[model samples]
Target: MSEQHSGRRRRPHYRALSPLREHLRESFWFAPLVACVGAVLLAGLTDLIDREIFAEATAEQTADTLLSFASAAKSVVSTVSSAMLTFIGVVFSISLVSLQMAAGQMSPRVLRLYVRSRLTKATFSTCLATFVFALLVQLGYDETTDPTRAVSVPIVSTVVALALVLLSLALFVLYVQATLRLLRVPHVIDRVTRESMQVLTAYRWLAPPPGQEAAERPEDPPDGPAPQGPVLLHEGRAGVLRDVNIRRLVRVARRHGTVLHLVPRIGDFIAPGTPTVLAAGGTAPRPRRIAFALNVGVDRTMHQDLSFGFRQLVDIAIRALSPAVNDPTTAVQAVDRIHQLLAVLAPLPVGELRHRDRDGAVRLVQSVPGWEATVDLAFTEIRICGAGQPQVTRRLTAALDDLLRITPQPRLPPLLTQRRLLERAVDAAVPDEHNRAFALAPDRQGIG
Candidate 1:
């Protein structure tokens, strides 16, 4: 009973925080909002310093000099205050337009790239901060009509505002450059591929050893017969299953001496009534506790969903292949990055990973994509959309053949299956025999 009470005390804080963290990460307003608040506080501090410390200047001559400096500073701060509001408006407008263009040209999923960009957030934050700081500094200026009288001049505040404006100007230029670069297909593909690779690198350890289960021993069942415990249903608003607190779930399972099986995979959508987990071989855990161990959100993320990367790449390729676009070259570029990701994933273990407690009981079972699913995800759509385009077809052929050569023997069948499908697609789509042959031939550069 004590153990049960202690287990109940373990709140699912990770589940709650993960989604919030992801939301903040993808929001454009949060950073700039923070910057504005910080600017206000900083301006107040500067004003305090100017009044308390700088107001004590010794001589009338010194006061006159300070008054002249304050007058010039007031003009500069006023100018910055008026200009920065317009500057932020124009800069952000360009940014939004650029994002819209990129989304239309590529995939909506790529919008996260813009949202998560440090440079982008930094640019916006700095500009907004500068604007707010300038306004505060201008308001802190002395209001006395008499020009000759010694008044409190917010000298420090003015200097800080000018520095912020300069910084904002520099960031604006870099933001423009980055936004333009982001519109290019190759750069977008590369960025997605790089993020996916990082996710893959982090995920690799959970994979089973080659041709073996990721468990304590072969006898340990990765997933046993379903437990008779009550099913845990999702109670939250509908969302894409983003991630899971597997360790926490395992702890819960271990405390109850049972196995917890996740019903929805990482990328699956879970509605309010959807089955989220099954507690087997022990007493059923509380539905709320189980639900709190899962992270759900508005869209899929790279956190634990490796296939999202492939999905994004395929979206880009097929969109480029659309008749309206008719840009096979861009499709080929997307395929190039897809092939690169596959090369990295090819030899790695691919299956569900089981987590065991210290006593070797299977506490958690995580469902992951197999090799075939991954290969099909990466190649199937591209092959279908790009079948008639010689550049795309040739590149697809080269990617499959290369994977066939480098991948482990067990992984060969999937690559072979994709290769055959590509061939069939090309055969069915390309009419001329010579053109078909050219499409079928493997060329890494896609006919270059």
Candidate 2:
């Protein structure tokens, strides 16, 4: 039997909606656009309700009472409509400042956190919708010359507008609170760690457990020697390879009687004319079809890139340790989170990169960073940058020691290697033996 027919499929392989969904999630406009449309429709409905029910009902009430109600409601709606514009301006102004501070103080990549915030989107959308709803309600106010004429006071619209105004006020408070919390280093670090943890969970599911990996591995060349076919070059704009349509690639390869090997890993930058896909075996698949199976975007997203999370955390740590910042405590805090993420990743079988169809033939092969590469990406920059800071070095040493205890024997070398390099760095950077010894000591809290 062919290798394709040999092993059991470990996880479900399906096309992801990451391209469209990720774009929409990260965009600041889509949510508000959807809310405004809904608000407009709601405003129209309230106007119809008022014209049909309140217009006739007002005829039965005294003229004095009707006039008073209409005047008061119109006053309220007008105030809310005008004030909502100011509210939007203030909210977004503060948001922009927060983004600027986060970019300068932390990593520019963390700006995505603010943009992708649901509270930020909700607050802006609610303020916008409230303004639209109140403005339309203000227009629905009807005037008449004669006492006998029925007045189509916007009673329903006024009530709905008031409710929207209250919602806006509530969301504004929540947004401000959230924004304040996000500005603090600990909160920001925790949020990034949580997101990375989610990505780690997804990765664990995609890759099989350690013992099962070899048994579940698919045959690479099928029957004969490895065949190499046409290479598909990247076309169009340069971008980071964000995701792969693995299922689609597998289907295409299976149909063509070929094995499709993706040239770039997730998070790799792809320029036009770069080799994207390599076909081997039977007939060559269409280059356009193969390219469509990949999602390349301007920025690296956490959707499928494992290293992106590590990249973000490391960026924050190094930025904090920079001389301009001189914030060693912040760097130590970031290292704490990094240690947590590494703990979660230490034991997993994270190397699986082959995709096979139902028959068990390897249809797609992609490259992924292995354990050593991940360890280096996580530690090398921080180890060098934070070498002089005793707090950061101590914290890093503590983390490495903890990881060494839990990591399998096979994975121990990378952690050991990082430890050796860290010691050399500390010895060279710190001239004083007492400070060097202090930095060498493993302190999980970095001296607390």
Candidate 3:
């Protein structure tokens, strides 16, 4: 029986693929899939070539062979085009496919713009590959059979492949143009970076201008009298990786973390050191010797803004304590409870949470809930992409800057330490007048 008659219809071809097979097929990024497809087509093509040139002995047989060859070619094209149109979505699979494509492991011929950024590029590259493959195959056939030919099948295949490839390339370019237009790359980068800059500000991360040393923080107020306001500190120079900056205002840093920003206010790189914009935590600028960094994106100064409000509430609560909550030592004692309350309400975003020791066992652990943090981190990622000119470094670097702002540091003993800081906060929060003390354990206040 002829192989066709015996009928083990060639292995279930790619086009006939079930959804799972289809997925496996497209999983390739650059497209070894194309080669695999091409190989199948090549096998089919070889079968056609044999039918045309050597499969038969008589003229009638040759005529039947030619007809079969035509049918085979049509089937190949139909199969390929169909497979190209189907898409499967499973985030992990998509990521895996993307990774493979990025590594340049797949075929370009199958790189469809509908897939991914890298895949889109691969598709464009594939168009070039198709044109070459078709032309080479046609030349090989012409050299072997030099038929002067008004209708040589090899020549026709070459022409059709070439034309299709050119068309595909054009489509690919059009898609790219549209995508670039939609994304408005330059604009989006700028908008997002600016947002990142603001985020850096919120963290009090400062990057001072080059050569201009940052003003130092004043010495801690002398230990004697009731000082007027909180000490102002000048933070140090800082820079953030462009990618970390968020387009959306969503991340929040607690305490003294710093985020940095790059300033291109002075044009070219040839001129050394553009000013680094620093975000600091103080209500207003403080003249000091120690370098302090400020976060820019946030509107509230830690000392001036957010803490002020929290402390105000603390003060109100303290005043409410009046005859009941009053203690002269309350100022030093009240802060931890208030801070714990604020910590509870922080609504912190998803972050690289850190844990550190406060005492030997009382470890300071940062908690960021999942879903809530993603929105802002994504925004930060988006913003970093848009940050412009010198574009700074990678988006992650800007993010690292942002991350640093939120990066929790260990609070060890004096430098008067976390304990003292909490105490001062409570002290500042105390009411103007301490009335007759009534009673309730200070530990119940959430300060402990």
Candidate 4:
């Protein structure tokens, strides 16, 4: 009984934590805000300490130190504070320009990578914190008062501000290097590919090992007398369905003795009033509970949406294939990365959308795209957009052939279909026989 009770207690805890984790993952300002608040508190404490210890010290008592050192501290902090403010403006301007270029040249979705970048946020926060700290220290220093009762110059605070200034400069240099790397086409594509592969690996369906006979698909739910009145839950807000907490949903379904069929997959847009789930066999869970399991956001994220990564790469590829850009080599690079990801995904189960409870009863059912849809998502757009470019056609042909060789026999049909489509596209686009043959061949870098 105790064990069962403990198990029941963990579900709500997990349900509460999932949204918090997602928010932190998508937000860039939280960390910087914390850092700035810490800086302000530290500055206040340091100022208090400086006033206590040196408030009564006379120049004669500290003659070993130059009086100019104390007098110049205020001037130095004031000048440094002004300089740091100017530096903040310059850094933000450069960052904005880079973001604009990236959005225009690549895809606007790639801007999220920049917005969530830790280096950019940290550098900006450090500069701002330094400016604030210096200002606080300068305000604490008053040189115009009578010499008999002059406010003590905060030596420690001033020295720390100097160190922060130097640190900000170092961070600025690193930020510049990071920004330059981000601007490079190859680097951006590689990063996007790497992230997509990660998402694939995380959510990939389990499959049998090589040389073993493939297992038969799981049997569908048993047909029985239908529930008299199934409850349909509608979405509360309209947004893209970014992720779902399946485990929590399964647990809730089991607890309520209901079977839940989720209507939308990750990356799907859900409108308010649309039926989001169909619950059979019991009263539907509270709407807020159902909604808690679903993460609906204004924009799609790479959280659990494997398609988002593919979308990013596809956007880049199509942009490159455009007449204005006219860069086939970059398109080829995107194709190569997509091929790698498809190979990773090909062996895995694509439509196994059932989630079972501890007793082995199916509790949650959701729709997922199968292997054919995934293949089309990855290749179809680039193939059509780059049909006129021989280099792109050749790379797509090679990618298809390579995928056919690497993926299991069960995944062969889609690869073959894609190959035939590529052939047809190349035939219709390229009139010259030589160029057509070259495009059809499995050449890695396309025709010379």
For 117-224, candidate 3 gives per-residue lDDT tens digits of 444435544544453444344333322222222123442453455465566656566655644432332222232233333432332222112332223211121235
TM of each candidate vs. truth: 0.88, 0.90, 0.26, 0.86
Q: For candidate 4, lDDT tens digit of each residue in 109-222?
A: 988888877889889989989988988787777665454565565777888899999999999999999999898878898888887876666434322224422343322223
Please report the candidate that would top lDDT against the real structure: 2
Model 4 CA deviation exceeding 4 Å by range:
1-19, 55-68, 144-151, 205-231, 246-251, 353-363
Question: Number of clashes in every candidate structure?
Answer: 0, 3, 61, 0
- In model 3, what is the error at residue 97, expressed in angstroms? 27
Error of 1 at 172 (Å): 0.8
Candidate 2 off by > 4 Å = 1-18, 55-68, 145-151, 209-212, 215-227, 356-361
Candidate 1 lDDT, 38-85, residue by residue in tens: 999998898888876455763333555566677788888889989999
Model 1 RMSD in angstroms: 5.1
Q: List the residue pairs that clash in candidate 4.
A: none
Ranking by TM-score: 2, 1, 4, 3
Question: Which candidate order results from sorting by lDDT in descending order?
Answer: 2, 1, 4, 3
TM-score of 3: 0.26
**Could you tell me how far off, in angstroms, the CA of residue 144 lies in candidate 3 after the best superposition?**
6.5
Q: Point to the candidate with the largest TM-score.
A: 2
